[model samples]
Target: SQQGEEDPQALSIQEGENATMNCSYKTSINNLQWYRQNSGRGLVHLILIRSNEREKHSGRLRVTLDTSKKSSSLLITASRAADTASYFCATDTTQGGSEKLVFGKGTKLTVNP
Candidate 1:
């Protein structure tokens, strides 16, 4: 959980606005994935962008991965109240000679109608 760091730990935006969250990592990764957790539910997969791919989009979500900078960003356009949740960026990274999926603390987003 320490391998990745996310900025703007909390964000509030009006419905239909765009919410952008950024994440930075410490080590090399293969596939960077974004997830959304709503309150008590488990993590829900949002998008997965490979290191070779610069950008990927799914529905209103757009994800960008930059291996060079060791960073990634998740953008939600036309945001709705349903989008209110904690978004986290996870990466498969090597640690202590073993590779594991590590997730950032996450950015809690609140979309108001």
Candidate 2:
């Protein structure tokens, strides 16, 4: 089954603007995390919000989780060209006894100078 899906497949913005991304998932999750990927590189963990938590912030990143809706949103403040990358939301799920992080398709963000 699909774990997570993100909306607005792609976005373009100017530097200093704010970028918002949303993710929707199915089933219960232990924790949700957001990551950023620069083109052909690997993903870098941004923030993680647990099932008990409603919102979290890290530097220029803000994340909100709504368990009732099985949805999460990530907001990036003062976007820069360096922030232009693919953002993804992942969910932590346990199967059998181990936990794993399942990632969504991701939203591609382009910040133009």
**Best prediction by lDDT:** 2
Error of 1 at 55 (Å): 0.4
Q: What is the lDDT of residue 12 in candidate 1?
A: 99
Q: Deviation in angstroms for 5 in model 2?
A: 0.4
Clashing residue pairs, candidate 2?
Answer: none
Candidate 2 local lDDT, 1-113, one digit each (tens): 56889887999999999999999999899999999999999999999999999999899999999999999999999999999999999999997798988999999999999
Per-candidate TM-score against the hidden true structure = 0.94, 0.97
Residue 94 in candidate 1, Cα distance off native in Å: 4.1
lDDT of the candidates, in the order given: 0.92, 0.95
Q: Write the per-residue lDDT of candidate 1 for residues 1-113, one digit (tens) a residue.
A: 48788889999999999999999998889789999999999999989898899999999999988899999999999999999999999998767888788999999999999
Model 1, runs deviating above 4 Å:
94-98
RMSD in angstroms between candidate 1 and the native structure over all alpha carbons: 1.3
TM-score between model 2 and native:
0.97
Alpha carbon deviation, residue 43, candidate 1 (Å): 0.6
Tell me the lDDT of model 2 at 32.
97
The per-prediction CA RMSD against the true structure, in angstroms, equals: 1.3, 0.8
